[model samples]
Target chain A: MAADKVFKNRIRRKLIQIAAFGFTNCHAGNFITGKLYNGKFKEFCTPGLNCYSCPAATVSCPIGSLLAVTGRADLKVSFYVWGFLLAIGAVLGRAVCGFLCPFGLIQDLLGAIPVHKFRLPKILTYVKYAVLALMVIIIPTVLILATGRTAPLYCKYICPAGMLEGAIPLLLTHESLRDSASVLFWVKLAILLAVIAGSVFVRRFFCKIGCPLGAIYGLLNKVSLYHLTVDRDKCIDCGKCAGCCPMDVDPVKAPRSAECIRCGACKAVCPKGAITIGFGSGRKAAKREGLVDMNVYSRK
Target chain B: MNKRKVIGIVILIAGIALIAAGVFRGELDVILRKAAVVCMECIGLG
Candidate 1:
């Protein structure tokens, strides 16, 4: 990828992120009036983690909606949200995180603040899986079975996106709501602040450590329709792609690694142009490039 | 298509079917009701 191409990609990504944020949050009037959009559009979910409670949001966060609907003792799990998420993940994988998530955009902007950014420790990167297993899955299931009740614990306790997108806007506009702020709000605010600070120092701290949604999408990265391929026959074992990867993925080594966000940074930096990303079925892109997909899934 | 491609298509079909079933079950209303209102839990309240 040449410098101009990289610049173009970056610009394109930023514009898309901004456009997505606007598209998802287009009910701007709701923000001024401090009211949520109760339109039929709320039935669907944005692919990224935009909060349904956000006044401007036209759709729901699938993770939040899943936990809320599933946690209820009376209702069966709403397969709609799950299916929507699954369909998106199957096609796009973590590309949703890279391109569509409003929260990801916030983190990316924070990461651009002329400051040193550290790659998350590999051990810490696995925390999101544990979070998904525990908070999103096991705990909710256990609570429902034991007490006949469950809650969206992740959104309530740990999701900084919910806090920033849903809570802050509501609180700012509604004095009565602000007056009712509790210890829980303070605690969540503290967590949100910590997450923001962490993002400043470490890229995608929340996505790498706390986002169950990211974990779920990452699981499908290998099989997703849109993905990256590294042409093995292009030669050169250069480590540039790995060095530039925001998610700490070594595209040459693990092109389909669960940690990859498919942001195209690696592809943008690949000197040999061995990387190809976007929508394609199976290894068709690899075959077209006259290269083996480097058997990336086998090694690391 | 290869196995991976087949698998992807299958999963996609399954997903769409599940969504349609959910809609038929009126789960769309459930999501709309939950999402249309201000959620207290999301705001760190009851």
Candidate 2:
């Protein structure tokens, strides 16, 4: 794709992200009234980490909904939320993070501020998996089983989206709702600030190291319908794609790496136009052309 | 279809079926009950 086309896609993605946020938080009237929407749509889970406690949020967040069901005394699995997430992941993997997440948009906006940028280490990318396993799943379930007390552990302790969307605005408007303020609120506020600061330097900082939801989507990225492919035949060893990848994915080596959010920045910057990303299999085409795996620049 | 494609399709189908079953089992109600209420913890209240 040409640079101009990439520019158009970038604009289109931003528009889509805005549209997604607006659609999920459709009850704009709730912001003024400072009340959550308690409609039938609340039964359904949104792909992003939208807070149900958010005044304008019409849909339940997938992670929260999952915990709500899973942390029950009966400990029954949440089929609906699970299936919905699986379907979404299977279709496009972490592309949802690229094109739909409201928080991703927030990070992108924050990243636009002119500053000395720093690269977040690849070792830290594995941290989100721990968040999913521990904060989102293991810790909550264990507490519920042991003490018979349930809580949205990740949302309570670490979710910056909740603070931004549900806590801040509601707290500003509903003075009565401020009674719960304590050390926890202060801690959460501090976490939100830290996350915000991190995003200013590293793109999608929370997604890389904090978001349990992204971890789930990342796990399914290998089998997702859409894939990122590099044509070895196009043959210039320039590392432009890897250089442009916000997620630090080496497209030539691991086109379908779990860390890849399918942002398409890599494909856009490839000067040889060697990359094609969509529903079709890039590996099969390479194999059909008798091209082996890209092992030249790839680390063992 | 190849093994990966087949596996993906099977998972997709199984997912849709499970979701439909969840709805029938009133799991949607479970989600609704939790979502409709103003969650204190989610808002960083407690």
Candidate 3:
């Protein structure tokens, strides 16, 4: 039974990685020939933070699309982009962070490297929302409204994903791009290096602390159809769920916390089989009962 | 269903409708044009 479980986990990881790469690889530009695929699929937005500027990217980043439309001189609201994000968030919440985002996949791999892992302070989790509000939304809107110039402030100044997936590949391939690289490029490179290093010691550092997309999705976790539910009756309160969580979410206490990526790591590690992922009001029912209905005694 | 589930369904329906309308209206052309170019600003070159 244990061997079967281990095999299933390995398969799950492989499938998730494949899906992550598949979304990014639809265009599949030729790296050797320095040709990026310019296909029709670029019209749509990918669910995760795959850089549109990346040679292999078939779709635009949703966050980038949001900023692009918001910062346009025309300044029309991107209902399509907003709607797309909302629908996905409502459906899956931050599951995309765990299973779809190429950058998240990279961070997960980096976290596998032998190192002393540590949990970040809970306060730091709120930083992504500030980034979402200030960098991704407010700043770009202000810049466009003030100067009538389109400025993707987050993509330009932050977004180490863009630097890693887009700039690095293009710069290495195209000499002109390399020659034109400036202080901003170097700054982005530094940030990218820091994020990469941080991920090794702190699993999903960017997703936990800085990803505006994650923040947007996190907001919908409470209402999302797919979410984690803890069966308090079965839980031993041994803290196994917390111990197994890579994102430092206490699934037993707050199964629907915004920080949770719905990665199912806790579900896999639960000795008491207390955690489950599903669609419904199971979590709300649990919450209403004040965590395991103490009124009823367990037969165990 | 709960209020949250009802609201989620409404939002999902509305979102799908908006996206479909946008597609029919040729807003995707705008997205395509923006995406066709290598966004220098996105890569921090500009």
Contacts from the true interface found in each model, as a fraction, amount to 0.75, 0.76, 0.60
Q: How big is the positional error of residue A145 in model 3, measured in Å on the Cα after superposition?
A: 2.1
Top of the candidates by DockQ? 1
The whole-model lDDT of each prediction reads 0.83, 0.82, 0.80
Flag the better candidate by TM-score, 2 or 3: 2
**Separate DockQ for every predicted complex:** 0.76, 0.73, 0.67
lDDT string, candidate 3, A199-241, tens digits? 9999999999999999988998877888787777788899977
Q: TM-scores across all candidates? A: 0.93, 0.91, 0.91
Could you give candidate 2's per-residue lDDT for residues A40-60 as a string of tens digits? 999998888888888999899
Candidate 3, position A169, lDDT: 87
- On a 0 to 1 TM-score scale, where does candidate 3 land against the true structure? 0.91
Fraction of real interface contacts that model 2 preserves? 0.76
Tens digit of per-residue lDDT, candidate 1, span A1-300: 378878988998999999999989999898889999999889888998888889999988887788777866766476888788788888889999999999999999988887888887799988999989988888887888788888788888788888898999999898888876889899999999999999998888898888898998998887887888766656378898898888888988888898899998887777766787877632466556554543541111
Over 4 Å off in model 2, which ranges? A282-300
